[model samples]
Target: MPVARPETSDARVIAHVDMDCFYVQVEQRKQPELRGLPTAVVQYNEWQGGALIAVSYEARSCGVKRSMRGEEATAACPEIQLVQVPVARGKADLNTYRSAGSEVVSILARSGRCERASIDEVYLDLTDAAESMLADAPPESLESIDEEALKSHILGMSREDGDDFKKSVRDWICRKGADRRDKLLGCGIIIVAELRKQVLKETEFSCSAGIAHNKMLAKLASGMNKPAQQTVVPYSAVQELLSSLPIKKMKQLGGKLGTSLQTDFGIDTVGDLLQFSETKLQEHYGVNTGTWLWNIARGISGEEVQGRLLPKSHGSGKTFPGPRALRSLSNVQHWLNQLCEELYERLSSDLEQNKRIASTLTLHASAFGSKDSDSHKKFPSKSCPLRYGVTKIQEDAFNLFQAALREYMGPFGTKPQGNKKETWRITGLSVSASKIVDIPSGTSSIMRYFQSQSTIPSCSTSGCLQEDVAVTPSASESCSEQKSVETQAAMPEEDISITDTLPDLDNSYGNMDMVPEKDVSCQSNDAKEFLTQSGSNRGTQTKTNGQRINNSKEKNKGMPSIVDIFKNYNATPQSQQETREDSTVSLTSKRANLSSSTSHSSEVNQEGEDRRETEWGYKVGEIDQAVFDELPYEIQREFRSFLRHNKRPNAGKSKGDGSASSSIAHYFPPLKK
Candidate 1:
């Protein structure tokens, strides 16, 4: 049911552009000799000379129609030429026709906001353009008009008067002080005529158009004139145009709804629907549909044209009717592979050209069972996360089909055995990719960062660097290395006084207050014990050289403490202090201290045995909730996994020992005894 909008008025200027016998025209362009001939495009000519999908107007005059067999078309029109659709991977390929449609859309999009209604049809909202033209360039002020603009069929004007009709249409178009709605429609007519000429000139394609105040009337008028002409539905002429029109001829009323109106209510024409009151119609068809029917009978529709240029999804399917149904798993697999290959190619093209990716893959199938009761059961459709590459798609599709087959077969039926006769036959198969989204900018930089991290060697606690066999530096690393060299070459050399820089470092270290030696040793011992306890529980930790040295404190007792090393490097000898007047010796001593401090810091920061920092360097409980939430999704996942792994033992202990408090104990106050 359609709902009427509040702004249902004749203030808008809309046009519907439809190609003239689109498929036939595409074929005629390919074979120049087929131009101006009675032609029909067919598919699968091997089966009863194929079926006609599109028929040319020249052939339609001879009674050749769509869905007619190729042989029947020839019998109806002896000289009719039939062209078969291109076949690839055992299926009909329509890429040629799709590409041609894109060419036409590019030209039509220049005049207004265009919506691609179908491959060969488009709807344009020309309200703004029409208003602008009427304001700046009125039709009456023009010195001359295109001959094509005068040929448009005006709805209210009768053609029985011939010259008078043309004069009336011309006068209405150029009439001064006319209704604003009429002026807008007149502007739309000229714009559509120009767009049609541009399309034909640029793409060698002929199209017809209809100009009206709304989408419904625009679509209704576009088809009124056939081939390469256009029609305009003026506001004053809408009533007369729709009064005699059959109810079945309306857009949404062509199916069961129209049949019900005719048989149930004995309604034959749009005028007949006017007799019923709104309340009475609502009683029969519900509120929305009743209001919609009442509004449309009076030439009032509020359906707006959507602004879109490309299709939301792409699908390739083939049906096996009657005896041609697939009976075995191998046959189904063979067809599925072909369909998957086609889908993969289209997805790859979209990703490359439009920078878009599809997130979902869906499979639809229709089948009938050998049993009379089971024949009516439907094969449920299934969808999964779409993965790129042809082989992965095929594998996933086959698995989805098997999953559906199980549910469709139910309890009484089992998997079809190869040695036994099959109980089910597949009648149709199709695979579609949807949920397309554009790839974000800077994705390449993110990918490069991850690749660089993967190539670096990882270190273990056993004092060894282990390189992954499969990992290696990629092109991004090579590019970065080249950039480093270029930057180094571009920099200007500067002279530095070593004496001046050495004193700054010495004074900075001398003034810093250091941790007590006893406190440092105690912290180291506590960390070692914690690591040992954690390693014993995990059963995977290895002892480092530093840990071994700490454990043998009684044997290698002469080893200097971590605080002693830093103090010795920062301390200034009394002899040097006494000889401060000797500038050369003072400078030498300062350089020695600076070098020692640098080496100590480097050793503390090294990987494996000398490294004192833990992997995360912070306790899980110390992490702030607000700060943790700001991390990227991938990093958050890793943090969650680490938490789960470390908390498992604690969770088990709390559950087994009744003395442990609950995990949520801190959330509430203790209950009164």
Candidate 2:
């Protein structure tokens, strides 16, 4: 289900560049002898010469296609050379091609905002570049265009006996008095041609590009011209190009969607789609998709090319067909370990090279029960928190598989513990890491800053935060000094040698709460800061613990602490009859508290002001508990210390807090500064 966007304005220049038979090109670069020959790159050569993933232009001319097996390709062209894709961990490896794609992206990114659409495709928004070119060096002023630009295939331009096609393209590209939009598109063509040449010169790879006003048009035009050539979609030629085009030839409508349009309304061409009213289309499809179809028929699309160079997620997987299916838990665990190993290697490289960490690990399996006649039972997919070690990933993957297996095999199906033969066979398995985030330096001690400002919310509207918790520093420790100490965690501590406590953190458990709860305490440098600062402020009177006790007793009773304010904020609403009475009482109580504690109130206000400056805010309910549980115990302990204040509650306090601490701190050492 795709949502329709606003109508296109054709104000931007977009280009889509696709590599021609990318896998074959990478192999050709490895062995120069295969450059001019009919070659095809295949994977798993042991199975019927493997499956052809890419076919050379020379091979395509000899009736060989990408879907054809190596045997069929060689039969069609006896001189055809077949190459196998690299294999690692019992699965096909595409790292070489991925690296090559990166080289191409590095070159293309120099022009403008570039988006890597796939391993061999990219979309670039060259609006600013084209506008700058038109302003600085308009195409009409040049005596002649670049040779590569002139070689572009212009849509709707007919080829005649006298080579009129080239002249038509040349005149249109350098048209003396064309519209500003057309001139901008011409500039885009020249820029794309230049980028293609750079890719070829630097990486020894050839590609084709399409220049148009939007991504859809660019994608359609890019495929029009094959291998080593570019195409330009002029505004005036758009109608003619699409009027007689088949609906299935369009970018997104080539599959089931196109078949639906043809079967439902007898629509076979783009021109036929225009016959139905927007309202009529809306009645057939939902409002979003209906309006989208109507606009695309008029040569309009508003999809923008995003600015990204890296993939959103990393995944490794393989399939076991029929007799090769995995039956025993040990067999499944072995394959899962291999997949996790590959995933971890890629993750380590990303962390080392890009300073990023992935936060979620997901497992997907394809299997069906053998004993049950209803083999249609589907394998459930499961995901957990992603940690940085290979052993952790393998453990988590095995857990996810077990969870999915339980759901896949219902009550009547064979259970894993049964002594009988295994009933469920795993035909495919995959593990992917997603929700990646970049880790910038100097963000280590953010928890101290939150505590110092009293900006931490003791209780949130979401039920996750309980209202009875309280955390407050000694009376001698002013809010201002706490702010200064907050900066300590940002750097290495000079006193305590608790270096092990600060193991390079990867991610916090879900969304970290702003304030600490009662009965929880941080014994890091931050806690010591309160002790040191309090002692200095009180004239260095007595022993550290003795002075702390005295300050707690002498603290002003009239001043409202963070805990009091949080309790008031979380107060329940009354019924309509008692609303007025409750409001009056609340107002009177608040005014009295503010007047007696003006300084403390000001600190609270300042904290609120600082929080307002943030770009995003989250509610406690939005946090995922399962994902949080999967986080490393060290991270969980640190985050819990920040969220809960150090306060020993009375005997009536809930027992749940102690249980939580015991579980999270089981694998973590005592907190040290």
Candidate 3:
């Protein structure tokens, strides 16, 4: 039998803080007159504009539900306020909402680990803060009357003083001479009350929370009493809670798995899952998922909650509606530019605040359903050692989209047979970055002053810290960095030494996405696809360690990452491409070869048929070793270290590979300062 390791006490404290009706709340906060009114945050007013992203609770009471068509909402509640979901530059405008989310997250992050899970959700590891607060409660509003009366009445009931108001409620339960069930219920109510008060006071926003021994339990409980309530689950209550709970309620058990549990194994409730053997589950689901299901069934999650405020990745996107849909590549590109710009601003902020760099860039587009529902496309992600300037980010992101589009259009189900309607309008478009890490080496100048006041994690020998985001080098400085990078790209192999700063290429591993269990983890949407060698004609090479990712569409399914592509992109001419002048011609030639010679494109051409062998211009196989050896010390160093960080975790290899392969695996393993 495999024993699950208990979550370590000091490992990390994670909290999932979800605002109540976030979009509606945003509107209500800005315009208090909207309070208690049936309000909804809508997007795309046309027939295709998806219904409400958010509707106030009051609207819900009035039979107004999210994703309800604006027309339907109006019909149900004539007085309902249906505000457009705001669009900017041809897409769903989310800037105002995102900004609001950031503010709430900043407030929540004040005392501990934090992650912004979504536009209106965040996670906090408030073990320290909670413990501190448990030591005291707010002063009474009045000294004489029912103020103490209220407190005493609260305390005398439960005859218990818990970590927070919950303990007082527990006492109330005792006063009622309640059973374990009643006591538990009282505790839950108190927890919700205390948390709600704290959130309102601290963030000027109201939120709901769940308190439990672990994240899964807490998360599950959090939703039970929503908006301005909290739920507490003691260790003893886990099994009872899971027994009758609907299987669908468990996170990650959506769609197929839920169906399978119901139809195949008759495991309608989480409790039923325990009847099957781990091996039996494997025989049904694949390996990775089977193991995951087994673990989650046992209430065991090895997931870590990251400590970050900025999104792990930045994404900008929009959906087209009705006749205003896209007509040509030019139109699509126009929208893509808008999305990329938004992503760039976010990336810039990350660089400014954390001095970190996004390791990859990816694009996604969904065409009109009337055109072809089968046409779900993902663009090839390209990344290079992330450069600081917005120009670099934008240029690279745009190019990556072109490459992805070429691949998606060709391999996926081809244009509806005979229907040449450019109305193949896109319903959604988004760009994201993944595998982000703090800038290499020490604290940024902005952070230096606060360094002594706060504790920072230790950095590698070369000095890369998780706290330093990339600084946008000024125009002249950016030019200088580029020249330095190009110069280093031209350096001789013999003259260069791969330092700890430089990620060792041999240690590269396929992309392994880490899904943070907390609010403050990596921000961006699966931080979109990315690869290296900027110029274009980019493609992908994959490696699956036999751990087949269950869903190919999900981000970071253990594929060779964009960084791996960059290493290939920057190869020296003698090793792959031939040299030009003093440096290897890899970047130039690689860009040229991007569209041609890629076999992977055929795979995504939708259906398995109608193959077209597009000739990408670059032949990466000919890039040289000297080119990599030569590069400005800083960029080269950063790239090398970035690779190292990503590869640190999976240092262990499969069966016959031995220690050499395992030792070569690069992972992003963070350690306490």
Every candidate's CA RMSD? 23.7, 16.4, 18.1
lDDT per residue for candidate 1 within 253-365, as digits (tens), equals 89998888899888998878898887877788989888888888888888777877777787777788879898766577779889988888777666555555565678899
Instruction: Score each candidate by Cα lDDT.
Output: 0.61, 0.62, 0.47
Question: Which of 1 and 3 is the better model by lDDT?
Answer: 1
Model 1 per-residue lDDT at 418 = 29
Per-residue alpha-carbon lDDT of model 3 for 299-324, expressed as tens digits? 66665556778876777766665566
**TM per prediction:** 0.66, 0.68, 0.56
Candidate 2 on 1-673: residue-level lDDT in tens? Answer: 5456774554789999999999999999999999999999998857678899999999999999988887888899999999999999999988899989999998999999999999999999999999999999988778878888878887766655344766776788788888888889889988999999999999999999998888889998889888989998888888888888899999778888888899998998887899999999889987888888888888888888999988889999999988889987667878988999889878776755665567668899998667555668689787755644565467557656655664576544433343435678899999999877554322232322222112222111000001100111121121112212122222221222110000111111111222222211333322211100111111112212212111112122232222222222224212221432333232223323333344344433333333322211211211222223433333334455543443223212222422222222223344322
Sorted by TM-score (best first), the order is 2, 1, 3
Q: Please state the error at residue 568 of candidate 1 in Å.
A: 55
Clash count, candidate 3: 101
Where does candidate 2 clash, by residue pair?
516-643, 516-644, 517-644, 517-645, 520-645
TM-score, structure 1 vs. true: 0.66
Candidate 1 lDDT score at position 121:
95
Report lDDT (Cα) of residue 403, candidate 1. 49
* Ranking of models by lDDT: 2, 1, 3
**How badly does each model clash, as a count of residue pairs?**
0, 5, 101
TM-score: which candidate is best?
2
Model 1 residue 49 CA deviation (Å) reads: 1.1
Q: Which regions of candidate 2 deviate over 4 angstroms?
A: 8-10, 160-165, 441-673
